[model samples]
Target: MADLRPQAMIFVTEYIRNGNNATQAAIAAGYSERTASSQGSRLLKSVEVQQFLNKTEQNLNKDLRVMFADHAVNAFNVLLEVMNDPEAQHKDKLVAARDLLDRAGYKPTDKVVADVNTEGTIQIVFSDKMKKADSS
Candidate 1:
């Protein structure tokens, strides 16, 4: 993942990190603007380029552990505040509650099974909730 690349490729990597846009990165790396989209798409699919970007992101995430921890805690705290605040908007509170439930491993599809008859053919099942959340 750390294999060395040409200077233009290096420049393109930095551009991609900054904007997360391959076409813009290609243009910023001095490629022809007219062909930037196609060139960028091609460059993004290159093994070396992918490795460089993936390694860079992995390294950055490794270095940002403490920052990520703080953000996670702050975000959860905000969610809890929203969930508990009666003055908060109903939609906001519902979102917070849903998030908390999700984090707690509660899902609409959580199931319970029981046998209502001596025969194996009869089964009873109950879902955590009848309503399934829209994944999208």
Candidate 2:
């Protein structure tokens, strides 16, 4: 990665931290209010800055996946307990079972209905230009 200037680094950090609001990030990085928007746009257009943002996003996604996986077993166990408990209310058990099935890729398909009503004449016109070209 290219060595970013202090202000550029701050802009990148603030851009991510502030929900990808470039203008706000530039302002937070001490850019002039009048130029913050353009400065942010320029920084984001830089190859080095883009690479940094992509890498940061990838790392954050990986970390979140790991965190979720770590607790997946506990979540499944709780759901199973609720689903299998005979004392549980029918509604509660059904909801738990549905959740488990949905997560397991056994969700029911949704039904869709479409209504169409048209009261207009349909017109089709052949262009003389096409015929003229074909004749040539």
Candidate 3:
């Protein structure tokens, strides 16, 4: 079987959340504008679908969510700092960030640079910001 597409998976999850009208959701899900009703019916009738839907519904937050909006600006600043290095490449950004993070008492993992767009601009997705493990 082929690997599941992320968009399709997300669409399914969204559909499970608000699926009173199956045909309407199918068109919105990009699966098929015409076969939404049948597809939604088939999925709704499946045991696997029932379990998946129940689990997802249990995890869903219907209310407005809390966010660290203060952290958002700081995050953008950090990105700017990473992008300002003379090299501005993955390896260089990682090294630069590692030094700064270490000095600030945060021990984040060494950055792994990935070029997602094939445009040569490296992206460093930091895995963690671990506090000093133990000094005492």
Model number with the top TM-score: 2
Give each model's clash number. 0, 0, 0
Residue-wise C-alpha lDDT for candidate 2, range 46-117, written one tens digit per residue? 998888888888998999999999899899999999999999997899789989999999986542333333
Off by over 4 Å in 2: 109-136
TM-score of each: 0.46, 0.73, 0.35
lDDT of 1 by residue, 54-117 (tens): 7777777887997888798998999999999989997899789989888888865555565656
| Segments of candidate 3 deviating more than 4 angstroms | 1-8, 16-19, 61-136
Note the residue pairs that clash in candidate 2: none
Put down candidate 3 lDDT per residue, 1-136, tens digits, no spaces: 0243454445457676575565565566776867778876775676665565566665564322224456656765776687576758877686667666665689845544455666767665543432233332
Question: Cα RMSD to native, each candidate?
Answer: 11.0, 14.2, 17.2
Candidate 1: Cα lDDT at 4: 46
For model 3, what is the alpha-carbon lDDT of residue 40? 68
How does model 1 score by TM-score?
0.46
Model 2 residue 108 lDDT score: 64
Residue pairs in steric clash, candidate 3? none
